[model samples]
Target: MASAPLNEVCLAALTLSIVFLTILWYKLTSNISHKEESRLPPGPRGLPIVGFLTFLRPNLHHQLTELSQHYGPIYKLWLGSKLCVVLNSPSLAKEVVRDQDSVFANRDPPIAGLVATYGGIDIGFSPYGSYWRDMRKLFVREMLSNRNLEASYSLRRHEVRKTIRNVHTKIGNLINIFELACVTKMNVVMSTMFDSNFVEKHRIDGAEFRELVVKFLQVMGKPNISDFFPMLARFDLQGIQKEMEAVLKSVDSILDPAINERMKMLSEGEIWGKGKKDFLQILLELMEQKDIEISVDLVKIKAILVDIMIGGTDTTITTIEWVMTELLNNPEIMGKVQRELKDVVGMNNIVEESHIPNLHYLDAVLKETLRLHPALPLLLPKRPSQSAVVGGYTIPKGTKVFLNVYAIHRDPQVWESPLEFQPERFLNSTNLDYAGNNMKYLPFGSGRRVCAGLPLAEKILMLILASLLHSYDWKLPEGENVDLSEEFGLVIKKSKSLFAIPTPRLPNFELYQ
Candidate 1:
């Protein structure tokens, strides 16, 4: 009788505890529901499981802009299992990029970017940490520093002049503007990274490097189904990841030998750049230095090198092509740019790098082209590190954020006639810069994650564009019209290749030599 009574008491206690726990759970869930109702950015209702995967468009930037109109500036979309936030307005973008820069500085690069960047070892995609900070510091202070650029001026000058001379030969022929720019830019990038003589020696062997860059970028920018569904990535469902690997293998074939040669040179105490080191020399020195703050291996060095090589080439070359295309499309703007060129850098002599700053109208034209055709229209996607509130909505952590600068740059509220190419709009706006400070115009993005190569890109772009406009007058190939329609990719490229004919405007052809 005594044992039976104890068992009954234990059972009654268990039932009471279960009831109490259930009441506690209900209260917690009700509070969570209330909190969720107030938070969570408004967006299109997505389907179960897949969310907005089915709604993705080929022209994502345009589609996102259109979506912003209906969903408001800050909106959310679920791509497969991923939560993506689109920041359309400058104010919204400012929150993610500026106010919460530390939280959102991390990038959510696609699989291809990861593979191309050696699994995020480079400064481009590396998390905001000691390694990234040190690498960036070294790159800015040593590699792409003003002093280093000045030291390498002759090489930049040589490559630009070489391109001019080559174009002079093909003056009457229809020149593929992007191809010309790509090759010329690549030449400069190679020389800047290594040695000019080193590039000259390896040009024949590295011919395929050009094609590899084109393919790598195509693969890097192409949308992959795997990125939306991480589970599908390993299967190579879209084949984008596989193709990127193949292109990288080819790129490695070129880079390995070149890097090995550089290593040998460093080991032999040749000091390729002497006292004024190139990127390769500086990187090699870092590897040899024992007291270096950042611990970087060969792989990290190579990844950083690739970032610089690809980043340096694509931004300048593609933007230069667009600048030419815009100038060609708008004859009035073209005349204005040429007149400014003539005034700042006379027809009596070829333009020098020093003349770049004085050509205000040309700068306006360049800026105008960028406004229309930002290299990355939706600047590289960023990922918030933790759950955060943005624009009065709770943006859950790890959500992919795309700041639609293209849309912001062309917003009707911001500009008088946003769609039309108007370089004059920027004529008096000396405060406006591409450095991401002005949210109204962030060609290079903003905040901590702003493009690491902005300084170099600015200098190279101004120099190259100024040189071309000053040295030559361009025409459409006999019976062709310029196509301003965009072909979106890693870089926003022209819908069709610009085939323009060039005629020398300089009094002395020898200046090109």
Candidate 2:
């Protein structure tokens, strides 16, 4: 008696119900059979085949945080066929990163990242073993060492001062804050790495380089069909792999010339590392000094350079933008930062690198900003090399582990009014340090595979935020309000770029120039 469409709908519903019930039954039996050996972590029983894919939210971090409330601190989700474990508490995070660090040091680099990172040879997401250790040491010792960073301070200072002068030129005009931050950070990075400055270089447009970086970042963050389903990876169903490769081509074009020039300089014995050591010179010297125990090849050098360039720029740019957004949204907090800067550096003077440490309130503001909006909210997905037990449950080998530090930072048990923006919490905190010693507050991640550029990242971010606040008063354009909404991707960025008007507060025009 029913129409044909109605009959088809009824049949489909019945089929789906049977499939769902059958999957649940299978899981129950499988668990019972393996119960004596190992207990699997508890999680939602999703639909057959696709698993929990249908329930995925646009903001994956929030969804994972919400799931934590129901599944407890440690829970699993079947994301399109891949088994994912989400750790929502500091203790659980400590167990994985600290208590049993080596076991989980392996990385399952996403499909897009694999192409972007040139097949996972880079330090950050490389597999756990000798190669990763070698690269990390080379980066920390040769490039990012305190001595090297100190030597490069003048380069960094030059870039920041140049940015201030440019900002001074357009004193009350509406400008994109993220663009400004990107160019400044790019200038510093280029100057330090290749003895080049974006502001001074007219041949290469700053906007072009900025666009390439943003595009590459978006690709790295995009949810590729291949990452969720390994079987689909070879097909390149969504073209994400191809797209990432293209972005890499553009980036490599920029980096290739620098690498070649350094190579030629080293071969010609031109006294490359005699003074003002750039990262390229350090790597070249290591490569030439065959007596050195560590490994340094041209391939490794380029890989590390790409890693530094991508990692350094995005994190600082996003942090500056977010800190400014939060401060603008809360004028009282903005006033507090200005007062601290005034007391430390004086109202007539602009902030400098040395004055940064003296401004404790500014430190609190930076820490608070990091806590609220971590650049990598999920913090570079880590993988287990072998089966491991966590929180009394068996975690199967190769399960992608998402250490939800963002969730942990917002845990009501750990922070008071966790959702509210409060920098005072960090004003005198003894336990919390960005060094990853405190499991609850690892802005740069914790353990062996942590971010290699932490020292520079901290210095650059703090100085940028402090200098900007000390120099100007900012306001949104007419009818435009600050939007604190965030977009989750490879890096968490504001849904919109922060565009505001800047007014110079300095008494002297000489300082601006």
Candidate 3:
């Protein structure tokens, strides 16, 4: 009887093992079939688990371009288990940014953006719901309206003049144009946002606020492995979150006092009519309204400051630096732009908003520079809140959608000699404008969430470039040609900091003497 029982137990164990194996096989096959049936846009097959994570180089734009050539315009790649669909062609980009605008309006929940802006309460990372709409409306009405533009014009003009003066002082010496551009842009942004020229104050720490701004941007822009693979995200593999949190704390520490003082002034009604009604004042006034009960928190204030600093300063500086780099590389185009500025602005006076419309060639050079090197080349990653079809492929809900503005801008089919630095291409096209209507050149992006500071940014860029060219001639550093190589981040900065020697030019001088 004991031997018989033992044989029965052995048989039952074998049967159970077989059943487990069969179930596992069925599940594995079903998963494979479902994955296959999804029919995601074609891409290079990546390894299991990691999924193209290893193939991504530091220069994301080049990598994406190479992949686009192989996998057509619209392609899908797996960033770990998450599906990232990259839209490469202009037509496809238009469909996502325009035709299906609302569908892809949401932002991906990257840890960096979350930490930097306190969980997407800021305008940039905020979702496409009521909060986003209200914040955007406030941003446009308070920060970027025509009255604000007029009030801020003198500040911008003064900043540009100071930039020219600084560059002229460093004439004939190799200067870091990147730093110059960054400082100039920050000064302008600060003056507009805070009603104070903090850059002008000589602090012992040497522009502590500006340095903090740079640190914040660097930390926010740095790539985090956690953002890609959630499994590793739990480990904080790259320590990106820690770094972001530290930087956020530092930034908050710096801005808290200023915010509190401003709040006090607003409560006492002493801030409104005292200054020219800067961005912070406007936001405070709006917050006082019964309809808009904007919370008075360090996070909300810091978030707004982040928007102003990152959105206003970084893009402006990058655009100016790139335009100057291109001009230094191709002196002839630079000469043309200078000539236009001289003729339009008369060189004795500063370039005003009125002069911008007349300087067509200068506009073209700016447009082309933007085309060749968009400030935010990838143009802020967006995700789908719901399932949708793009280019006949089903993009499932919660899929990260990257509108590859860099790739689309460089598409050979859409642009003639896409790789070349040709500003004249824009001069001939009427369809190209920066108002988000033009799908071809989206330097400031398009759709409902297009950059709120577009008008202000354009004015600043035009005025700053015009003033610089109007006052000085730019040349590359000694023994080095202008480097066109690019570096990747939230913003696409030049690989090498743009180093140039500015030579003060005679008013209206067209040629370097």
Q: How do all models score by TM-score?
A: 0.89, 0.90, 0.87
- Model 3, position 496, has a per-residue lDDT of 84
Q: Model 3, range 1-513, lDDT digits (tens) per residue? A: 889999999999988966664554344334323554476678888766556778889999889988989988888887755678888877887788888889888888688878888878999889898788877777777678888778767767666776766775677898887788878887777777666543243121337768887887887777676776554577787888888889888777666766677789667866343446666666666666677534434566668878887767877888888998889889899889888877887756766778988989999999898888988777788888777778888777777888788887888778889999988888888979886677777877899878877888889888888877887877776688778888887788888888877777665433222
- Supply candidate 2's per-residue lDDT for 173: 98
- TM for candidate 1 is 0.89
Candidate 1 segments whose C-alpha is farther than 4 A from its true place: 1-38, 202-204, 271-276
Q: Residues 267-361, candidate 1: write the lDDT tens digits.
A: 88775655645677778778888887777678888898899878767778889899999888888888888888888878787777778778888
Residue-by-residue lDDT tens digits, candidate 2, 367-466: 8999999887889888888888888888877788989999999999988999899999998897787888899898889998788889888889888888
Query: What lDDT does candidate 1 reach at residue 443?
Result: 91
Best by lDDT: 2
Ranking by lDDT: 2, 1, 3
lDDT of each: 0.81, 0.82, 0.77
Candidate 1 at residue 327, lDDT?
88
- Candidate 3: where are CA atoms >4 Å away? 1-37, 197-206, 231-235, 271-275, 291-298, 506-513
Candidate 2 residue runs with Cα over 4 Å from true position:
1-38, 197-205, 269-274, 478-480
